[model samples]
Target: MAGLACAGQLAAAGHRPLVLDKGRGIGGRMATRRVEIAGQACGFDHGAQYFTIRDPEFRMALSPLADAIAPWDDGGSEPRFVGRPGMSSLPKAMAEGIDLRQGVEVLALRRDGSAWLLETKGGLVMARHLVMTMPAPQAARLLGRDHPLVPRLDCVRMAPCLTLMAAFPGAAPRPFLHHSSGTDPLAWIAQDSSKPGRHAGLTCWVAQADPDWSAGHLEEAPDSLVRLMLPLLAKTIGAEPEMALHASAHRWRYARVTTPLGTPCLADEDGTLWLGGDWCLGARVEAAWQSGTALAKALTRHLHAG
Candidate 1:
């Protein structure tokens, strides 16, 4: 969300900003996983379940892509919104005119005279200005501890998340749209199928473990995590584990920002390198958009001044 937001705004300002990601597709945490069960294709929003639009600019930014957005009546009062069909839809739409190169991993970062050189697996790519929109720890590691920007990231802390996606027959019990528990190992469980624009053929459920539980089993294998979380979800939803048509687990190392940097973004003395993400503010999607947008505006001013 942060990377795409920054890139989108920069592009709108008539600047060509290049976005490189190691993942094969767009939308880092706002992801959707597709699976075939009983020959029916189903999607699970295993990453970010839903997002709320409190910022006016965010609402305006999404107005142009209304077709890809939907209201998720999670019984919440604040009016939550989700990407239609899948959570990845919004990010994919936001990436429409941006120059994004996926599957390009940056191994190292170095200053080459007036520009920044990124040593990616594909080779070196140079940029007069560089923005690191990844998680704080990842950006810190890439910049090394000695880098000035790294110190600012030390105050930011993120928590991991272990999510389980399971699909069962359509007759499974629909207890609630979403359930959250602080003490339960499975902290959050939502009926992914109940959301707008989702396939109704199968009953899909997305379960996320609490931070403590997730951190404890962070190193476990995917299959092991699935085995551990499947029964818990089945019990909560009043379904049998054997009745599941498809089941999988995903681990997000830095899923939620527990302690944010309390700022919009960070930049070096030269204003050539920058760091920003959801960790800059709260964990909401709006925070990422705000951080990225703020960073882009600052960068625009700097470029114009030069």
Candidate 2:
């Protein structure tokens, strides 16, 4: 979503931009998957549950996709929105006219004269300015040697989260329940199929483990971790899930931002390189969008000054 927004603003200002992601598809964390059982398909948004818009600029920027995305439980009051069909649709909508390259991981970034060179698995590309929207640790790894933003990067911290999705053969014991632990491995648990989708008879559950738990078991086997988490989910939901059609574990090494920078954005020494992500502001979709917009404005100013 950040890449798409950045590319959109840059293109609107008459600058061509290329967006690349290491994942198989766009929408870094706003991910969705199709779980098939008995020749029936069910959509599940296993990543982010919902996104909230706190800033006016972000709300205005998202207004175009507002119809495609609707506010969740309008009477609640907090401005939370979900994709009309699913969360992934929001990012797909934003990437409408941009040149996007998926499944391309960036290997390294180096400065050459007045231009920035990005080395990816595919090849190398040169850009007058470089905008990085990855997590602090990942971004630091990409920019090997010391740079202006390296010092500040040390202050950034990320939390890990593990989401477990299970499909049952029959109806769930309970309709829906959101569970959280005060200080346990379990953080949040939700029924996936319960949230605006088909496959009602087949129960789907998502369990997000706390940061400490995820960090400790990051290297453990996927099956082992799932076994440890299944009981907690079963107890919370009041029944044991039967016939696990699909049980998968996702380790989000950079799931949440613990300490965010005070500023909404940051620029490199040469003004040609800028950094932005959820960590710059807060850990939410809105923060990501705001960071991208701020970087775009800063880049526009830098380009005009040149």
Candidate 1 lDDT, tens digit per residue, 1-306? 999999999999999999999987689999999888899999999999999998889999999999989999867789998899999999999999899999999999999999999999899999999999999999999999899878889999999999999998974554546456567799899999988999998999999999999999999999999999999998988888999999999999999999999999999999999889999998988899999999999999999999
All models: lDDT?
Answer: 0.92, 0.78
TM-score of each: 0.98, 0.92
Estimate candidate 2's RMSD in Å.
2.1
Please report how far candidate 1 places residue 259 from its true position, in Å.
0.4
Q: What lDDT score goes with residue 273 in model 1?
A: 94
Q: Summarize candidate 2's per-residue lDDT along 221-306 as a digit string, tens digits.
A: 88887888877777777766444676777777788898987676788777887888888888888888887888888899888998
Give the range of the ten consecutive residues with the poorest summed lDDT in model 1.
Answer: 171-180
lDDT of model number 2: 0.78
Report per-prediction Cα RMSD to one decimal: 1.1, 2.1
